[model samples]
Target: MPKSKTKKRSGTDATENRPKRSRQSQGGTPVNSASQGGGDVEARESPLQGHKCLWIMGSSIVHWAERTARLDDPQLGFTKHNMSVKWKGCRGLVFDGLDKLMDSMLMEMPKPQFILIHCGSNDLTSEGVTGKMLIEKIQCSILRYQALFCKTTIIWSSILQRRYWHYAPLGAGKKIEKKRTRVNIAIKSFILKNGGQYIDNNNISAKEVNLFHTDGTHLSSLGNSILINNWKTALQSLINSTPDNSLLTLPTATL
Candidate 1:
């Protein structure tokens, strides 16, 4: 985590003033401070609007989806179909990784109508974890989210297969590549089984040179275009659909 500065003020004064917000890094999480016990404590609020879509993912999303999203070009009209786009991008973070991002950032946030979840790139590198086991963990997490956020629609983006996997030490890269494929299949199945949507990155291909950077760890400019377009397509449909709040009145995963 990056260190941040918090402005201190008198308790009385703090009550009248809204907390200040600052970004942790160039494209990292936003750090905010609220008054607490004569000091400021880091805090976060729901960044999403009541009706906009939220994208929660890791570094690849930071480079691909978020980069396109942050472009303030007026001609682009960042807003799509009345949706206020929000991105929670962190490098090397996963739902179950060291950061435990899902628990810390999402659990208590204001629920949105749509969300795109793409994580587990770092989890693929964890030792002794098989693809099937990883998928099971992710499934349980989604089930909990459904139980909690009944009206919110979740779209799980597949873990992308990188081109540089062959460059990894010994057989690690190859192993990761194979596991990614299996995990993707499992994710798609789980999402559908639980009545969730799965986004299969259409640009994932060996011939898509513009999709990845030199290290094969991040997305190139062209990659961002492809990803953002995909998001727009998926979001348009959901935004146009009539939402049923009672979809998850009971834990559907148990069924």
Candidate 2:
């Protein structure tokens, strides 16, 4: 994470701060938080108006991509639909750290109708973490979160295939890539089987020119754009998938 001064306090939302909210999405899931740039102010100023709220949460992948998504752009359809979007990104976030991430945000904003999670690439390179082990941990977390969050829809974003595996030995790249595929497949199957949704990001792989930075770990400008585009598309598709607008009514989270 690019260390910065603690962020200024973002004030109350326009919507009535409800007690625990039920979550739902077109396909399923939500987006979250503020971006690295001053997008936090932009999100705070928008009135949620009880419409669909999406919280996009993840690692720096999300932090770097919010400006490109521009969900807060008033001229965009997202604004017209009266949906609220929040992006919560952290540079060094890992898979198991998601619980802590959400816990930290609980009191900051209203519950979102969907939570679109795009993380886990870092865990693949972490010491002693195996693909199967990560998947099992993820399953436990998902079920526990579903129980605690109640109706909150959880959407899994597939980790994009990386050309370089940061922190691993030079020869470990191919092995890590294979693990990435297995992790994605296993998690996707689990999420779908459990009535959740998945965002497939295989298109933004290393094969694409300039999609990744020279480090091959993070995304380049064009790559972030593609990533956000896929997210926006998923948000729209999921929002419109089910006609159960009644499910959009949310309760506040218990602090």
Candidate 3:
């Protein structure tokens, strides 16, 4: 397993100051953290005001949104959390566990009307996982979520290509990129087939990646803003398409 390059904060700082929260209680099965006031606050205020978009993120998404929330939108009332583990990667067994965790979380909270999923990069980096296996894992995760939360709209973000070779073993990075392309092709097919929506982040530049991170693997404040801008455009389209309650009636996926 690859160790996280990021440093861990002191326990006091972690408990007191972290804005991004896990739905699970510490050492427990994942459950929505309403008592902690860490989920969507907008949903709490009148329930009819803003669209409750739950960002079910991977490590990359967590890295991006944590920086972005602090710098750009402190008032942006959305829930950002991670289920992805570094080096464990996005395999069938990993996603099977994620499905159970997510199912437990949804059962406790009102189902989120909108879900944004950013994952699969780690799956490409894993040694034993194949593109076919990655796709099947994602498919299973999606179907499981759909069954649990029948009305949620899902936005599947495309795996953003690396700005430069960040992985090792000579030709390994290229091979990973090739596999990523195949995984994305499968994701696009599945999204189109299931009436879900896709967001392509491959168009983001190396310069943008640099601005977003000190390292290639994570996002900086600037990088997070780029993500939010891109995602917000897609979200606005969905909000414009129907009334708020109609959002709950929309298909399981929307871009």
Candidate 4:
């Protein structure tokens, strides 16, 4: 007898006969189907994504640096989203006050990837807070930031010089200017020793200052732009030194 011939089923028939996937049934729960894979993928990505730039202002800087960053370099990627009062009313306050301010600011916006600290001029000119005290305050701020957010790049601007040197009861005009220089020197030293960055506006001349501002105290629109531009350069320099992968390992801890 001739072998019996068998006919193959049509594709449509085979598909119709195949096992159907149930909407509610589990091969794996739909909600969790990609959970493991997605989580692993996210874990592999760097934690520094969405990091924020924070500007912390002392009393003088509250009026100066913060305003400059806001109006001049809105593009600098820093927001008043974080501010701290390191000094008060034309004078530097107690060192403890700075500590408190840093703690509170960090708690409120903890993941700052970059921090700009502007102070010391007030300390020297107003309260006569010594270079040692200023250094202590700066060191405390650095240590606190490092302990809480290791990835943050801290930038401290050098003490700015003044056009009007005499504030009654302080001293002769030139004497005050001398004090400003001393404070600026101390600030630069502290920055260098601590592995932080500094921006020197002290070297900015009277002619340059006049171009940026009408008032001796604050900068004009052009001045603000200059200030922000300098700061941007410093920020870029810091970024160039840090690697994306390494930033992920930055510590996040409570003060």
Best model per TM-score: 2
lDDT per residue as tens, model 1, 1-255: 122225432111101122232111111111111111111223334465554545555555554566565674321243645555556777666557523554555554555556578788767766666777888888777776665455556677777666554223543555676788888888777676666766666444434555655554556656565555555555444454444422221111100
Q: Write the per-residue lDDT of candidate 2 for residues 1-255, one digit (tens) a residue.
A: 123334442221111223232222222233322111111111122245557677788887887777555544512257667776777888889988887777666557766667778888889888899998999978877776555454456778888766556567656666777898999889877876665667776556565546666555677767775666666666666666555532231122111
Best prediction by lDDT: 2
- Residue 144 in candidate 4 has what lDDT? 59
lDDT score for candidate 2 against the true structure:
0.64
Per-residue lDDT of 1-255 in model 3, one digit per residue for the tens? 124467632211001122232121111011111111112122222143344545444444545464455565532433332111111113222333555545455554555665667776656656577788889888766665555445566567777655433433444655776787888788766764564656665434443434335445555555565555555555545554644323222222211
**Which 10 consecutive residues of model 3 have the lowest summed lDDT?**
28-37
Report lDDT per candidate. 0.54, 0.64, 0.49, 0.44
lDDT string, candidate 4, 44-86, tens digits: 1124455455554454434554555555354454334232222
TM-score of each: 0.67, 0.73, 0.64, 0.59
Rank all candidate structures by their lDDT, best first, as comma-separated numbers. 2, 1, 3, 4
How far is 180's C-alpha from truth in model 3 (Å)?
1.1
Better of 1 and 2 by TM-score: 2
